[model samples]
Target chain A: MNVFADAIAWIFSPDRASGALPLSEAIWTHLAFTVVSVAVAALIAIPAGWLIGHTGRGRELAVALSGAARAVPSFGLVLLLVLVLGVTHKVGASTTAFVLLAIPPILAGAYSGVEAVDRRVIDGARGVGMTEAQILRTVEAPLGLPLLIGGLRSATLQVVATVTLAGYVGNWGLGFYIVQGIQIRDFSQILGAALLIVVLALVLDALFALLQRVALPRGVSAGRAPENEPVRRRRRGPTAPAPS
Target chain B: MTWVTSNLDLIGRLSVEHLRQSALPIVLGLLVAVPTGWLAFRFRPTRGLVLGAVGLLYTIPSLALFALLPPLLGISFLSEANLIIALTIYAVAIMTRFVSDALASVEPSVRQAAVAVGYGPWRRFWQVDLPLAGPVVLAGLRVTAVSTISLATVGILIGIDNLGYLFTNGYQRQIVAEILAGVVAVVVIALVVDGLLVLLGRLLMPWTRGRRAA
Candidate 1:
């Protein structure tokens, strides 16, 4: 009860502003895992999506595969991976977990980004005799940037939260604190871990928002609501789920 | 077969109890979320805070969250309280988005007409807005339902036994049939619930088909 009460008091304590957390290490490790895994997924998924979308084939197959991937349940897959890969403190386990986590969002973003690219714009660029490479680099990247950023944002958040769960498998994460806190029934440690995670999520989300604006076309690139509008921090992924 | 034969009545009773317990938390969640959502919509500042609180609840792993709560509450402690609360937190987060959107989505023209007819704020809300928002709220409810079904599997860690009991039991004990049964039941339930939601969504919001198609 002290654990729970202390946690509440700690959280609701008037000195919350001055209270420190394990936020820094958690943030750094989480961001590294999230950013790297997502970047890698993008590197793979974007090209694949561009190819599939540009050709208007294989998109369904890729999406269906991702849908199947979603059903595998992250924890279950991680357990299986531990057996196959042999766990270590190295990034292998967490990276693999994040990779699986990262794939769906990247694929969704890339496909939509490509499909969402206006045909007329592509045609106009092509008419100027831009090669496929030039057209992709110039036209598609700018157009698909928002959706791509949206995908990355969601993938990052999902990875962070799931990574917490991953800690129990001996992977050692901020979730280490959470799982440990739970065992001893320590609320401060648990709450501390939880608080650390949320702050990290929001910060990473903000960074992505900044990156999105810089990465997107002038019209689409606005941070949350730039200059005046309220910034709605919506992290989007969510593929079409099963027909049901 | 032996397990079932030996524990036939126990199995039956447990299933019934589990269903009842599960349904209560889910219903409680939706009810709480609706009012929170309405207030959040009314007071914009509260929206983020409420959703943030709910989201924080969600990020806490199911077992850990449950453990934290039950200790504090005591026989105000049912074994299922934590699961209920965690599930409710999730349901609220998703449902809040649905409801707030639904309320805001009430057509301004309709609101204007309601005002002209001297329907006060409460009347406009109850009669005009709620009716319009029904489908979205249902959709949110369905999402909550499906999500809850999945989260219930985590209940195994606490020995709070639901369908997950079957899988965890079988897997740990090396009983293949039990694991298969559990896995099948969960997957089928999720599918059925999801399909039902889609059907309900369509039935409730016939107009959504056009929107989806477009």
Candidate 2:
């Protein structure tokens, strides 16, 4: 009957959700909510952010919008969306709400990532008769991939954590535990729900860390070239140090 | 002309009410979080974990985060204290990041210089470190301020009155003007508050102007 013991048991139990299965619809629904939102946010953010970053004027507005997006509370944004579009709208509306939550990091990442790509590298790719797409595909994306992954890492963690609040609008997730916990004054349930959220965040972050490593393109490591090794020897003529 | 004619007064009233809702929590939240951050720096492992916990705190949905408080604290259905508590937690999340980053940024050379001058750690922290770190801390404060202003809208989702009430209420009643007015008010407040924080940062630390500009 000890609370911690009860919580640990429930957390680890193989068949906690169903008659025979451990995971429940609530858990799956939460996963869907997070997945759909992150997907939507990324789809919108990447190209738009990259395009803006490529243009000198584009960076300011994109960054400003992201700044505003981050400033607004996720719950408030949700409430606004729910009002304009009812909860029953499901995928269309609910996903939009979560997308708002997911976007800031994506934009921040894409914009900064594109800008941070080495110009010399892009130029070299172009000189090799590579098309713009080829240059981006072969050069820029490889270097920017880590930052992009970093953004997804932040965005995914945020979506999972905030997804629980969706339960109040008839979408069940870990918020069920918190709601149920409060109704019974079961600290165990509250702790379980809270722990699930923390686990979800860490688990999601770890998976992305793995993906970032795997997803990163070849011949470009995130680290700067190793110590005491020359990255570029002088071109045998007076040349200015390359501008960042 | 038709729309503005009908809704002008209402927009003005809502703006004042929302500012009141927003300012109270931000001022109070900063008061609580800044001190907690200061206390946090004195300890090591615990401070790191506590701040990490705050980062996690950033992940919680603001509405649920607020609602859960009232139940646990045994407060009434919609307590101001509960609102403040939620705001405080959000504030702490930001303030901790600010304080820790700012403090960490203090160069070791400066600390060494202070010690060399017979200034003890406490004296040095109070005199040199805190002042030097003040601008960064204030930069974080500016971010927290902008975020808190927008978040105060979550106040309406619970039971407190704020601009969100306009949006929520208007939407429930199908009044487009109220909803638009509310959104505009929250945005304006955010913009103005951000400007003020920048101004305050510059005025408080003239050194911050160049740092920010550069």
Candidate 3:
């Protein structure tokens, strides 16, 4: 349709390059918000989750806390922070909101990932005279890599989606285009911005999927091959409930 | 404190609107997801396609989706229907996956036992599979409900009436207390809904309680 064509053209238009709302600038800003927020969230959540998963204590509390946190609306949070902190620190307020949004999934992922490791493996390591730290590092960490990465992927998606809200406070990211477009009744601009967001999200998703595959332990990955049905079944045994 | 007390009636009305906006999508989502999920589960070939489509829907940014709907649906820009429909799409997208997974979690032996006992496919699904899947499905419902409640707040951006209205109003008037009030109300609503769903799930799945007791 003409609308699609116009949006595509608008994105590459020379006039846009020199303007205040450059396409490249918006993309970079969005990415920065996502990366910074996810990094901070990972720093806070991954450690807590790792400790909780490693100790196998306070799991219910962790899950409940994360669930409640996830339910806090990012939009309200952003506005509340802006109001309380004053718009003087717009970027800081937005980053705080993004970090809050990013934490729950990453925490859950890291916790669940470590928890998903077989206790028997941990026991085996312990029997071999390995210390708790050694067992965790040598056994649990490697096996849990896939899930840790999975949590990162979930966190990334959430941050990416949420960072767009930063535009509400001011001229932030791709959301600026959508918000401004709506205000000015410019459909093409809105569509163009949305198209860019979709493409970015899809790219990130594919990259994480590849990372998940590559992060799998070699034996576990090999066990997934169709010809290795017996091995596959055995590998799954620890996770699956025991036969009644 | 005085600000909240003075605006209690307005806050109550906004909370009601928020509930209304959230509840409709969940109901609609359940109605659509059940059949679609069953179809995906029952048919091997369509499973990947169905889930892939739904997962893709989940990735769309809420604001983009909200903006995209008016043009796509030919509705007025400000229609409350836009919010409901957009939220419903998200609910169905998420719920479908949960429904299929819940149904998939029903033990094969239990299903086989139902079949062996001379139950037809419909009878087996209704009497055995569905009840078995109840807990997981209810868990999904709780998640969906909470997320929807939060997402409904985004409706404020487009000038739709809800708790988000307070966020915008407070921002415009520079009233931090009012904005904080909105935050508290939204969080409370989400928690209440989540708790109610948990209680509802427990009541409906008495077998789960019995199993836990043993």
| Highest TM-score model number | 3
Q: For candidate 3, give the lDDT.
A: 0.78
| C-alpha lDDT (0 to 100) for residue B5 of candidate 3 | 95
Q: List ranges where model 2 is wrong by over 4 Å.
A: A1-23, A52-57, A73-90, A114-135, A157-244, B1-17, B28-47, B70-77, B210-214
Stretches off by above 4 angstroms in model 3 are: A221-244, B210-214
**Poorest 10 consecutive residues by lDDT, candidate 3 chain B:** B205-214
Ranking by TM-score: 3, 2, 1
State every prediction's TM-score relative to the real structure. Answer: 0.71, 0.74, 0.92
i-RMSD of all predictions: 6.5, 9.1, 7.9
After TM-score superposition, what is the CA distance of residue B113 in candidate 3 from its true location, in Å?
1.7
In model 1, how large is the Cα lDDT of residue B47? 71
| 2 against 3, candidate with superior lDDT | 3
* Candidate ordering by lDDT (highest first): 3, 2, 1
Q: What lDDT tens digits, residue by residue, belong to model 1 across residues B1-214?
A: 5755665565456455545655766677678877887876667678777766654554444444554565456622225766676666666666776676666656667878989999999888888877777765775676566656655665654457676666546544655555444544554565566677778778866776666511
Q: Model 3, A26: alpha-carbon shift in Å?
A: 0.6
DockQ of 2: 0.16
The TM-score between candidate 1 and the true structure equals 0.71
Q: What is the lDDT, from 0 to 100, of the residue B6 in candidate 1?
A: 62
Full-model lDDT for every candidate: 0.61, 0.65, 0.78
